[model samples]
Target: MATLLFHLGRASFRFRWFVVLLWVAVLGAAGFAASKAPTPADEGFTMPGIESQKAFDLMEERFPGAAADGASARIVFIAPRGEKVTAAGNKAVVERLVHSAADGSQVASAVDPFQAKAVSEDGTTAYATVSFAATADDLTDASKSHLETALDKARDAGLTVEVGGDALATKPSAGGAAEAIGIAIAAVVLLVTFGSLAAAGLPLLTAIIGVGISMTGILALSEAFGLSANTGTLATMLGLACGIDYALFVVSRYREERAKGRDPWEAAGLAAGTAGSAVVFAGLTVVIALAGLWVVGIPMLTKMGLAAAGAVLVGVLICLTLVPALLGFWPNAVLSRGARRNSRRHRRKQLRTENGGSRWAKLVVRHPLPVLLLGVVGLGAMATPVLDLQLGMPGDEAKATSTTERRAYDALAEGFGPGFNGPLSIVVDAKGAADPKAAVATVSKEIAATDGVVSVSPARFNQAGDTAVFSATPSTAPTDTRTQDLVKTIRDERADIESRSGVSYEVTGRTALNIDIAEKVQASLLPYLAVVVGLAIVLLLLVFRSLLVPLKAAFGFLLSVLAALGAVVAVFQQGHGAELLGVESTGPIMSMMPIFLVGIVFGLAMDYEVFLVSRMREAYVHGDAPKQAIVSGFRHSARVVVAAALIMIAVFSGFIGAGESMIKMIGFGLAIAVLFDAFVVRMAIVPAILALLGHKAWSLPRWLDFMLPDIDVEGEKLNRKREVAERVPEPVG
Candidate 1:
């Protein structure tokens, strides 16, 4: 593999112009395709086989136009203190708002608060329901404008009005600030690491180019593939991060080769062969972990994972080809001032000096037992919060307090109870009953009598008169554990209800759907982890030719992931230090956050493991003692690893500035995970454990070693061939 990569790198460097032009042309083609492509679809959260999904499908089949799938808004109104919304003036204001909303474009109907009995017991609060013919994603701008105008009029009439619901949900536009900030931080880190402006800019340039191509391609193919509008978010985040990191690795290696007196062309080839091999394997691990999301059977998650994987693949290709080609364009300018002025002997002397990495490595090796115990105990303490982790879908309640959605959610929860924000739609099918009306009435009564039932709306029959639909509100909040139990209780009692009432009913709607999706994701977590972890272990075993190293890497990954999750729960769930991070409200963490953290962090954790451990393995293979091999690995690789990890951390932390809660949670979790995995697990625990294990750390079973193919990740074979050719004197040519 290394020999093949060496030739490929040399050829690319030899034809640098062609390599550059090819990428430019590809980028142009992708941009053109993106320009002509249709707008991306908005496929909201969907679960195929869950109970709520089945109920939704049944409702659409039986009730058609009346299915609870259309966009809806709850416009809550509160009168001034000592004033009742039931007063003549206040009532007129409420009625006017409902009428105006009903006349809005795409509006199906609007229910007056008085007529619908939606007023609070005190008559100071009321809410009107407006239903739209289209889904939230399909609502026209004119519809939103009309609603906003009506809201303004209501506020002018001395009534406080706020709106919440699917109809008002808008996808936040990406302002590009986060990406810019992340890039700026990465540039500074690269500049410091490389100590040369020319070298520092190469990774940024290649990363931006790779991101442009991948993002444009994703946009171009989105409509055809039914990708959601948010699909490119993960793609962009991972692409910029991995692209820069991959290029950083290759560029660092090229500089190291040049420092050893190798010429430009030869250095580029060797760097690509050695460092690029690690990049390829590291990229494959990420792709495998992401693509493994397919096993979860969630369409949205699958698309996100695949899109991110594609972006990482592009980064790998750019590092292998474009990076070396760029190096061929300016060889001496890439070296730092100190490196350029130093002679071969001086450079060699500098390389042998004991650096900070070597000093820290020696310290850990000398006290392996204490270092390992400290790392384990610290990570374990951080992971304790995971025991109390609660997962659920964030609703308007979790939104920023400044948002109208959150204000409305608060008003409704105050006036009509917390359950008002998340009502469950109950669909009763009575076609087989002797008397469908009687069956529908019986079912509604049974549902209203359920333990957690706050109230049940009057059942409305479809045109066929065999199906009826109503809503049931639980006593607890949407994300409360009791709400989940209430949903389960309803479903569990369905059998008895059906037998007695001669009708079948199912619970669905936004609330029930959230519960079902959370449960489904939780159930799949273990199996998904099993698949990703097992695959990574096998890949590591092949790369390092060892069992203990792979096992140790996996264990370290678990510690980092759990510790990250614990941090997320502490801030986002328990509300510890939430104000500093701008979290206005806290409850359960996002349902899929755990799985996402596991999948992405696992891949990235292995990246550091492979890059760091491979260097040690190479040194050991070349006849260094185990302790010295550990020191050599840190000396050569630790600086780049630290820079790469910091770049990733910056990229992810930038997303924390997003207004969306889910994006913030994802960004924060990933940033924390990288911090723990890179510094604590990889830097601290790994060397200590390797030191304790000594030579046994690199041992593999004879039979397994014989069966596995040699990947040549360290370019050992290429180095041997080069050594032999150098000694042969070229036949006097």
Candidate 2:
């Protein structure tokens, strides 16, 4: 196979220019179309599955009065301390803020719905509900700025003001800083990883194009299926991450072959044959893992599964087709001098000699038990911090650092009540029981009395209504341990509520849903991870045709996970790098991050495991003993692993420096995992243990061996391929 690959690689080198040109035209076309592609970050988009949208639609359908008057912007006001606010003073403040909104015209037209409403039963806290001429989704910047000016006018007349809620949160411009940081960090990583200013720039560019297209498609698509705004950003970011990562793998491999003296065409072909094959395998693996999210049959996870899977599949194809075609035009642009060298046999010989290794080798060769035990102890120590991780997924509320909206929520929670932030919404739908209103009120009363209750809002739409979405705040802030505790209290109180004579309620929304999602994921993550690990072991066993190789890889993978988890617990959970990373520590990592880290790190770890061991196996196949093969293989591949790892580390750790709290875990986790997998596990532990195993490292029972295919990555025509691979006169170093 290597002989054929070499010949094909040679031919590709001859036609390198053609291949590079092909890549250029394809990329050019993709870029042109992508530039015009739409994204969902537009003002017209609706927040799907929102009851307010439904209520507004129903109201429009029934009376059309609400839509005609447009919607209201909430104007919150706090009265001065020790000063009593009379009805006249409240009315005066409202009228003045209202007039400012209308530019001195009739105040009703600009703030028709503005009314003095008690935020608390006491007159100390009052706010104006100011309706605007625009739909909730159509609020202009001028309109928003107008509100700001009006608030200033009210403050000038002596009132503390804050403006927020659904309207402000839904602005199309929100999260720009966070998203910008994510993109900028991604750009630098891509550039450095590919080792070319232009080329690295291209992967990120292509990913952005793909994201724009996907976002637009998702918008149009979601309109059909009623997906939400959260899905939009989630899908967009995920599409970029998967798309860019896939392209990087393929493009990097192609570049590697080119650097090895293969012409563009040959490098492309070899890259296709090796890395390309792995891309298909890896892409499929991603698709399968994501698709399994649906197997548990949860709505959110299922949708997420399909969205993520679709994104990865699309990315793989773009990498395979578009990237290759683009490369067809840049022959010497990405190529370097290494490809001109002759085969280096001594390095190959040293690598092969590990299989038949010497006396010093006997230490590592005879100490499998000690190494394995030491590995266990190290892993255990690292895993100790994992017990302290608090699993909580922050919502859209936490996207900003110093945004007034978030700060206002925090301040409100502090002064008004603990649960004043984004808490669970409980909707009670009454049955045929008489006095249902009284029963609903009773449930609300009980909820307000629950432990950790900061306070509960007055029953929305009156206590007796069959449908009520009452807001419940907790003693702790939203998405914090207190809220988590509050959610548990609500769940614990569910049966008690069921005993309410006339009403039944289903609790849902950000707070309750956090607990639900976390519980579901926690219960389900183990199985998915087990499947991932089990499948990986099976795949490695098939690839290496050895039990020991799979076991070794699994051990290395375990160490990698512990090492990452430990570092995460120490830095993020233990608040070690908060200021350095420019993020306030949000204790308890996201539940999904660990699951994601496992699969991703494992795939990458297995990639190195396979690459290193395959070469070692190559040495063993050439008649060297197993000990020599292990040492020589590690010595040769260690630098490559370290180089790739350094690139990954720099790229991911930049996220830690980006000053966004949301992505710190992802960036820091992946970087630590890569470093651990490369140096401690792959470099030291994996080699030591494997070397100790000797011939058993490659041993498979004869009967079982027949079921496996012989994979000669070196080549099919062994002697001929050996001559070509061993042709280089000097070692790479």
Candidate 3:
């Protein structure tokens, strides 16, 4: 692998212009394809093989044009404290708003609150449902504007009005000022690390170009592949972070080679062969971890995982080819001025001085047991909160109170009950029953008597009268545990109901769908972790050629991941310090958050592991003592790892500024995970553990070692070949 990469790097340097132009052409083609592709569809929430999904599919089949894919809005109106919406004046305002809303572009119909019996028992609040002909994503801006105008008229009449539904949900934009801020911080970190503007800017430039290509390609193929609208988000975040880090590693290695008196061209090849090998392995681990999301059997998550894996693959390719080619353009500019001007004797003298990383490594080595204990105990304490973790799909209640959606949700909850915001749809299949109408009525009566059910609407049958649908409102909030139990209770009692009424029923709706999704995701988490972690362990064994090292790395990853989850639970779920982070409301954590955090954090955790541990392995292979190898690795690679981790943290933390609760949770979780993994686990715990184990840390069974392929990830073969060539006497001409 090292030899192959060495040759490829040199060729790219020799043919720099060709490589550069090729990438530019690819970028342009991707842009053109994206421009011509159709807009992505807004598919409704679907969980195939689940009861809720089965109910939804049956509804779509039985009732044409009544699929859940269409957009809908519930405009809630609240009269003055002393006045009832039933009063003549307040009633007039409500009727006018409904009429105006019905006239809006794309509106199918707007129900009158009085006729629909949507008015609250108190007579002070009412809500009208506005149905749209198109899905939320397909709704025109003009239609949204028309609805907004109608809302203003209602407010003008001294009534408090708020609209909530899928129609008003906007797609969150990426690459906003927050991302810009992250990139700026990354640039500054690079500048300080490299001490050369040219060197620092190169990584950022390559990363942006790579991310642009991946994002455009995702956009171009989204419609054809049925990717969700937010598929590009994970791709963008991983692409930029990994691209910069990969390039940074290669460039840092190239400068180190140059400092050793190698020519510019040879330095680039050596850098690619050495650091590039690690990059390939690191990139593969990330790809494997991400792509493993497919095992969970969620289509949206699968698309997101594959898209992000592709982005990481692009970063690896650019690091191997484009980085070397670009290095050929200005070989001397990348080197620090101090290094370029220093004499060989002075350079050697400077290298002998102890650096901070070396001192830290030495201190840990001196007190390995103490350091290990402190790190483990500290992280374990942080991970305690994870035991109480709760998973759910947070709804409008999780949104900021300032959003109309949240306000509307609150108003409805207050007017009726918490469950009014998440009514469950019950579908009855009475096609083979002796009397369909009697069976439907019996089923509705049974459902209304369920413990948690507050009310059941009249059954609305299909044209053939074989299928019927009704709504059952629970007494708890959408995300409440009681609501989930209510859904399960109805399903559990279905057998008895069917035996009595001769009709089969299924429960579905936004609430039930969310419940099912959360259950599925939770069940899949362990399997997903097993697949990702087991595969990564094998990959690490191949790279490091050690059994204990891979196990240690995996264990460290578990600690960091758990700690990160614990932190997320405390802040986002338990509401501790949520106000400081802009969390307006607190509830259960997003169902898929733990899986995402584990997969992504595991991949990035391996990145630091490979970079830091490979250097130590290289030193050990070259005959350094175990303790000395630890110091050598820290001295050479510590600075780059620190800078890369900071860049990743900055990029992720920037997303905290987004308005979307899901995005904010993702960003915050990723940032904290990276912090724990990079600093506490990799930097501190790893070194201490290695020091405690000493030579045993790198040991592999002889038979197993013989079975495993030697990929030479540490570039031992390349260094040996170079040494042999230099030792050979030149032939006289």
Checking candidate 1 for backbone clashes, the offending pairs are none
List per-prediction Cα lDDT, in the order shown.
0.89, 0.61, 0.90
Better of 1 and 3 by lDDT: 3
- 691: Cα error in model 2, Å: 2.2
Query: Model 3 Cα displacement at 669 (Å)?
Result: 0.2
Q: Candidate 2 — what's its lDDT? A: 0.61
Write candidate 2's Cα lDDT for 343-411 as tens digits.
465235323533322333345556766766776677678778887776666654444545655555554
Instruction: List TM-scores for all candidates, in order.
Output: 0.96, 0.74, 0.97
Q: Distance from true position, residue 540, model 2, in Å?
A: 2.3
**Between prediction 1 and prediction 2, which has the larger TM-score?**
1
| lDDT by residue for model 1 (111-212), tens | 999998989998889999898889887788999899989999999999999888778875652325985797689889999998899989999899999999
Model 1 bad stretches (over 4 Å): 65-70, 134-141, 170-179, 343-351, 730-733
Q: Which stretches of candidate 2 lie over 4 Å from their true place?
A: 1-95, 98-138, 155-160, 169-284, 295-379, 395-401, 454-465, 480-486, 710-733
lDDT of 1: 0.89
Q: How many backbone clashes does candidate 3 have?
A: 0
- Candidate 3 per-residue lDDT, tens place, 378-478, comes to 88998998998888888889888878889999999999999998999999999889999999999999999999999999999999999999999999999
